[model samples]
Target: MIVVVGITVGILDVCELGSHFILMSITIACGMLSEAYARGPPAPNASTHHSERQIPFAACDIAQLLIALCWGITGDIAEIVSRARIAQLWAATGVAVAYMSIARWLGNVIIFDRKKSRFVANAVYGLAFVPYATSWCALIARFALAINGAEASVPDWIIAIVIGMFFGFTGTFPIIHALSINRVIDVDAAEVAYAIAGVANKSLLGWYMWYGVNRMQTA
Candidate 1:
């Protein structure tokens, strides 16, 4: 229902503001919910065995890495040489982070059987859309751009790598939580796996983005 409403409003421009982000959040939230349902209820005597505990965390880590790589490459390809590129990257990152956070929150609420007031749940859902209209993501992008401006001739690949790494690292927490909610892995082991995957993903994406950017800059 939440997903359907969000998609409808986004398509119809019912809110006319930040509909993209709202739709994204709703999609992610729904994905999490579906996964939780697929996993069914936790066993009453569920015990975390060593191998069982490791598998989901490992899988989540791999999934996050792939997701990060895809996003990073897409951003790199979309980036223009103007200052607006920074803003674009930041906005994209903010949306990704927001989606992950909302999904994780929803998953946690479902998994733990915690009750939330309708107002509170709606408020949490609203957080995903806030970044779309907020200046904070842009501000952060500006700060980052300013720091990087000192080195004008830095290779495009180097810049790509740095941006990918930053966003990838920042996004890990929520990814882990989402995985946990899906019962993919125990939450406690998620940090290490997700971190490792983030690093790998970002590093590869940086190289790939660099290649693309270099080609464009030289052309």
Candidate 2:
């Protein structure tokens, strides 16, 4: 709950990690106050580790920061084009993967509800990857522009949606499946569904999606 709420706060603003911590403290303090005032029975299960494990709080935080930092690269693509830039974008993504791995490790080691970790972490991480992908798209667009010149003409919003949906599908859906929806209990059903409609569907669909994104440049 706290982690999800914190992530939600972060999503609302780029500077939310700090704000989330502060907000959490205030909320905890208020909850304590309310508990103290109650003259009747005890409060709810406040003793349990949130998600049933010791969340790699620092690790998860670092992951979010790492992700945000990777996103910061979009700001530098132009410099990259004319200067020294390598196709090391995967490195940026790796940092995020490590963090997510840490979170999962925390979940398993601590006996946290695996399901919870699956959903929240997936949603957060998957959605998070979009900016990084966008950075690449922008870099690509810049290169295309440089070659073709004259604006090369394109619609950014379309690119935004394609990029957004790509990450959303690639990252989010599987996580939602493995974690939140607990698809393992119904493997056959999941396969049928994913085969026909899920992201597991194929690269052509992905390419189609990417093509739509390219149209953004002309839009």
Total clashing residue pairs per candidate? 0, 5
Q: Per-residue lDDT for 45-70 in model 2, tens only?
A: 64554434333233443444344334
Model 2 deviation from native, Cα RMSD in Å: 18.4
The Cα RMSD in angstroms, rounded to one decimal, for candidate 1 relative to the true structure is 17.5
Computed on alpha carbons, the lDDT of every model, listed in order, comes to: 0.40, 0.34
List ranges where model 2 is wrong by over 4 Å.
1-54, 59-111, 114-150, 155-219
Q: Estimate each model's TM-score.
A: 0.31, 0.29
Pairs with backbone N, CA or C atoms under 3 Å apart (clashes), candidate 1: none
